[model samples]
Target: MLIGEVARHSGVSARMLRHYDALGLVRPTGRTVGGYREYSAEDVRRVFHVESLRSLGLSLKQIGRALQDPGFTPSALVSDLIRWTEDRLERERELLERLRAIDASAPTGWRDVLRIVELMQGLDSASAARRQQAVLARSEGVPAPADVLAGAVLAESDPHVAGALRWALARSDGDGMATLAAGARSEDADIRRRAVLAIAEMPETPGAAAMLADALRDADTRVRGHAALALGRRGVTAAVPVLVGMVVEGSNDVEAAEVLGTLARDHGCADRVVSALVAELDAPTADSATRICLTQALFELSVATAREVLRRLASDDDRAVALVASAFVGELDGRSAGDRGARVRSASGRRKPRR
Candidate 1:
């Protein structure tokens, strides 16, 4: 076959085939009277072979060596090709993500595009300060897309920066709630924790509350605790049981207790919250330390019902529980007496004649 025929038969273009011949990768075997290049069957086969290797991302120089060097081992070259392909694919994927983020941001101009890109880079920066600054700048000016903030929030290891990122996501359009919700179900406990924390700060979007509700059942104690705290703060009484469990476990038990107190302030949920706490305290299987933590958790509740319960607990059989409960009751009594004394003194002073 001639060059044109070879180019027609195979997908390789004529110019590329000639270039391959000059590179000695697939030289023609014969020439016509007009001195035009002519390819034998074996030469055409070599052309196809070169095209095959090229398809595998082999450079022309590498292909030349691969074709001509009998000592050349394809294993090493193939491995290298795989690595190079992976790198290119990664780069392409990153570029695609950047484009998608930009599109989602709906940048009004090149300046807006540049700002978003810069903010994204800063969010991904190794320096936590830069990440924090990025979130601040984005919040103050061009808000980053929720997806970008979501990604940053999940991967951020720094507490400060992660807080800022969550704030930014909450302050943004809130389209990233789905990403955060998916992250709440992540197999990684750390990621799940981060997701819940971020979502906890988000506006109570329809799906966010449900995601947090699901997270209350997570196997990770931290995840469950965060979800419970968030739910309690949101006045979701469904969190009462988990909040009680957190008090039993002594994980953020103070905050859990405080949130439970807030829930108890509601006349409807108040009895339920007190009942759950007392039930945990009443469990026979609860260890001494757990019982002690539960006793301490009672201090956050100042209602008359809680005081009566603490008075009953003050004389309990467990020495540690009795100590904590008695101390709490004593503190409450002292504060109460001090308030009464102040009121009486003010009344007496008012009743006295001015000098």
Candidate 2:
């Protein structure tokens, strides 16, 4: 067969076939009468073989070694190829993500695109300060896209930077909410923790309650605790059990207690909150510290609802518990009925500022 015939059949261009011949990768077995590069059957087969290897991301040098070196390790060669392909794929994916972020931002001109590119580089920078500045820097109408902010927020380890990113994400037209919701469901506990924390601050967010409700069931205590606190603030009853659990576990139990007290303000929710607290207190599993925390938490509830529970806790076995519970009872005893109601109302209504 002639080189033209082989090129036509093998789909390798003639120029490439000549280049392959020059590299000694595939040499024709004979010459035609016209002196055109001639290819015998074996040579044509070698050409196909080289092209096949090329399809697996092999360089010409690697393909030549694969075909010619008797000692070359095929498995090692394929492993390297796999690694290279994977690396290329990762780079391409990152590029695609940046492109998507830019497209999502809907930039109006080159300046917007450039600003976004600068922000993206800063977000991915090694310096936490640079990352912080990236999130805090004004875009002058070219807002950093929400997905970009969301990704930065999830990966951010610095507390101040993460707070800045969360604030930026919240203010970014709410597009980042979906990214945050997905992060809440991530298998990575750290990510879920950060996600729920960010979502917790978004009570004004439309679907944040549903995400928080799901997070209440997370295996990580921090994740679920954050979700419960966020949900409780929204007045969602679904957070009651988790909030009660937070109180029992002593995980931010004070904040948890305040939220519970907030929920307990509703007459219907009041009994349920008081009952869950009572159950934990009565359980032998609760240690002195757990009982004490539970007592403090219960104190957040209205005196009308938890007064009886308080009276029972006053004479409890633990001296600390008795002291704390006795102190709570004494304080209520000194209040007029209206003053007692006002006291509970005061505790539940005050909220620490969310980032």
Candidate 3:
């Protein structure tokens, strides 16, 4: 077959066929009467073979080696192509995400677009300070998209950056509550911990509350403690037990106790709060130190029932427990005396100087 005929039949452009011939990849077997290059059947088949390899992302050099070198194998070259394609795909995905973030920001002009893009890039920077600055910059103007802030908060390791991201997320119109909730479910403990902590900072939306409730059951103590503390502040009674357990474990025990004390102010939950603390205090597994921490945590409670419980604990069998409880009780008594004295003086002063 003539080169034109092969080009017509094989669909390979004549120009490319000439280039292939020049490269010795598919030399025609003979010349026609007019001196046109005539392609033999085998040469036409090689043209199809090269096109087939090119379709799989092979470079011309690789294709040439694949067809000419007896030792050349498709496996290694195919693997390389796969890796290159994956890398390209990853880059494309990142680009798409940035574009989406910019779109989500609804930038008013190119400057807004540039600022948001810069912020997004900074959020992904290796330097924590850069990431922190990005979040800080977000508050100054051109806020980051909700998804960007959510992603940054989840992956952020620096406490300051995480705080700024959380603050930005709370202000962004994007719906990142779901993202944070998913992070709460991550198998990575750090991600779960960060997720719950971020959710804790979000406004007390129903979704945020529900996510926090789910986090209360997380296996990680820190994750649960954070969720419980947030929920406790929101007055969710379900967090009471976990907060009490935090006191027992001595992990963020002080904050947990503070939450528990706050919960104890609610008349409905005060009994439950005081009872949980009393149970832990009375448990055989609670060592002397654990009991002492629990005793101190009781000071956070203002409920009369908790005070009565403290009075009873002040005479417990363990001298250390008794001492801590007695000291707290003494402090409480001293504060009450001062409060009464202040009230009396204020009342006397309100008597209009008898003039």
Candidate 4:
């Protein structure tokens, strides 16, 4: 059989046939005397296998690997594929049900009408397997179920649909923490940020701490901040040095300060971390926000070291610094005026005499 005949018999396009040939998935059995390719009956069978694997949502690479294996069994692969398809379908069904509920409550509009029509069109145009395959393909390379779920959330207008997808994705652990961590190195900042956050929420597993530590240095401020927060939440004190570095760099300093405060409060490094954060507060180049965050963090630490830092900042000439210092002193003293003398002195230092 020629390529044309194979296309005609198999109901697959010539372009796809060429694709399979390129992938070595369905190679020609021989060549004619004139150098044209010829497919044997067995070659057609191989094409069918390729098509079947593709229909079951296997990528060309995955199919190639399975086909090359001596123990490969299409029936077993198909069964597993069926289970995955069924699970995806159930998720979509749950999402649709939630959307239906929301639709009933909301006022009907052109947008709502269009959404219903689109859903109907999707149902009319393809079988459930095809739909699931399309969805899975679109979400290829997503590390965890949560990352895919986050994408689904972004796709839907209804919160319920988004929420349902999130629930489904979260419940399914499709990939390991290592895969999710690798996604953190993706060139796409958004993907990297989401991947880091997903791993942060994952159950503590081997190498999870190391992955979090690596994510703490991510170029994206949000990714780094979330990594720090995750470490603090898990009471992983090893992240303190990295969090302190972020504080010094002024990247998401507020979040870094909060995480440091949490570390100080729950972990044993309260005194040392608080002292470092206070030193940062006193730096001449430190921003007003950094100083404010440091002040708040000191309050959270609530130790003698923190109190001393607050006292020094109270007399700093920067008005913003003085204000935060006054607030901290007031919070601790039960009255606002205990720091009043220092505040007056600082204000006088900044005062200009009338001409």
Candidate 5:
């Protein structure tokens, strides 16, 4: 076959075939009377083989050596190719993430696109301060898109930067916070912890409450703890049990107790909160420290049950717990005296004076 016929059959352009010949990669083993390049059957087969290697990302120089050097081992070259391909794939993935971030910004033109890209770079910066400023610095008070913030919130490892990212997300329209729900379910516990923390701050998102509700059951203590605290602060009664557990565990138990008190404003939910705390105090496994924490948690409740429990605990066997309970009793008494004084003054003022 002539070069033209070989080019047509092999889909390798004629010029490329000539270049291959010059490179000694696939020189045709024939020539016509006119001195035009001619290809034998074996030469055509070599052309296809070169093209196949090229498809596998082999350089022309590498292809030349592989086809010509009988001593060349493919193992080392194949390993190099694998590493190169992986690096290329990783670069492509980063580029794709950058593009997606820009697209999610919903930029009106190239300027907005550049700004978003710059912010993304800042978020990825090695400096934690730069990353925080990236999330906080507004383009004339226009925050980064919530979706962009959501992505950063999940990827950020620095506690300060992560807090900034979450604040940015919370300040946005909150619609994009939906993207964080997937992170909440991530197999990585750290990611799930981050997701729950971010989601906890975005309770206004459409399903934010339900997402948090689901997170309350997460196996991670931090995940469940954050979820419960957020839910309890929002007056969600379902968080009562987890909040109570957090009190026993002393994991942000003070905040948990405060939230429980907030949830306890509802008479029905108040009973459950009080009962759960009292039960933990009564558990045989409850040590003195746990009892003290529980006693403090009881002080958060407004119900007579909690105060009565505190009074009983004020005389309990453990001196430390008894002292904390006794202090709460005194504090409660002080509050009662203040309340009575305020009421008497108001009633005295309401009365018709001598005038």
Candidate 6:
């Protein structure tokens, strides 16, 4: 086949074919007697492979090396490409986070605006111009036509803007929550916090559970507290055990108590949590707040088991326990003749049988 035929079959321009030949990357099978380049079907296939690799962001040199190695597999090459893409995306995320922090800390200013405009101009030459344009246009007060022209310029020249746009698309339209969850493991506190918040706002999917659980154990008390609150808001019942553990064993008992209260009310896990709380009360080191929280959770439980647990706690020697137990007795007094008599007997036992 002639060079034109190879170009047509491979979807590579004739000029690129000549360039490939010049670079000794993919030589034609033979030359015609009249000195025109001639390529075989094998050459056309090689050209397609080259184009595919190029599309995957491989350099011509890299493609040439892969072509020379018979052991190279597309899967291995794609694995390398994926690693490269992820690294690039990580860097882009870091940059965007920095930009967000800067935006949040300082009032918008001419210098910042100039810097953003310059960044946009740099991206105008990349594949993500249209997306960057859309993001810029959404900001307040930039007229539509000016935003378009500015975005076009940024898309053409700025690699960062292009990379950011690519990352945004991959994040928003693809597995963004998964990516953000991975980010949550970063040693940086800000990254972890941002990752948690980002994942919390994402569409609720089953995959999000593990991340929320991790956030519940985060070293930052505020982050852990927020994660628990968010999970409760989502009514993620699967998180009940973790939330209960936080209530029972948290370093910040007040925060844990508040989160547990919210979980009891919002996530419908009051029964399970009340049971854990009652068990905690029997442990000698339990704090007054834990006892109070337990009693409150029992009230929320409003079940036969709750009544039994409260009666047991009320019989304890601790005054705080007695007070909460008395409240539980009063609340249960009107339920039924059997329940009322049982509570009266339990209260009589706690009062030394009124001797």
Q: Is candidate 4 or candidate 5 better by lDDT?
A: 5
lDDT of 1 by residue, 102-153 (tens): 9998888898899989898897788889889988876355667899889888
Each model's RMSD to truth, in Å?
3.2, 7.2, 2.5, 16.6, 1.8, 14.7
lDDT (tens digit, per residue) of candidate 5 on 1-355: 9888887899999999989988899988878999988888888889998999999999999999999999999999999999999999999998987787667667788888778788888887889999999877858544477777887888889999899888788877534655688898889989988988988877476788988999999999999999998888777888889989999998999899888887787636877888888888889999999989888888988778888999998899999998999999999989999999999999999999796
> lDDT tens string, model 2, 1-355?
8877888999999999999999999988888787888888889889989999899888999999989988888898888888988999999999999999999999899999999999999988999999888888857588879899888878888999999988888788546888898888889999999988887765477887778788888899999888888888878888999999989888889999999998888535998898899999989798999998988888788658698888888998889999999999988787767787898899878967679
- Expressed as tens digits, the lDDT of each residue in 1-355 for candidate 4 is 8888999999989889888888788889898898876899999999898888788798888799898988877787778888999999998986785465335425246555444434333323335443343333332222223333444333333434433433444454443454466667778776676666666666666776787788777788777777887887788886776677666666766676677777777778887797677667767887887667667667766666777778877887878878888878778876446578788999999999989
| Model 4 stretches with alpha carbons more than 4 Å out | 1-167, 173-178, 241-255, 335-355
TM-score of 1: 0.90
Model 1: which ten-residue window has the lowest total lDDT? 135-144
The true-versus-predicted C-alpha distance at residue 208 of model 6, in Å, is: 2.6
**CA lDDT, every model vs. true structure:** 0.87, 0.87, 0.86, 0.68, 0.86, 0.64
Candidate 3: give the clashing pairs.
none
Q: Candidate 3 on 1-355: residue-level lDDT in tens?
A: 9877898999999999999988988899999788999888888889999999999998888889999999877787788899999999999998998898788789889999988888888988999998888777664666678888898888998898889888888877776877787888899999999988888887765688888888888888888888898988888899999999999999999989888887888637888888889998888899999999988888888778878878988999999989888988898999999999999999998886555
Q: How many pairs collide in each candidate, listed in order?
A: 0, 0, 0, 0, 0, 15
- Models 1 onward score TM values of 0.90, 0.90, 0.91, 0.48, 0.94, 0.42
| Model 3: worst 10 consecutive residues (lDDT sum) | 135-144
Give the Cα error of residue 130 in candidate 5, in Å.
1.4
**TM-score preference between candidates 3 and 4, better one:** 3
lDDT of 4: 0.68
lDDT accuracy of residue 142 in candidate 3: 67
- Writing each residue's lDDT as its tens digit, candidate 6 over 18-47 gives 999999888998999999999887887888
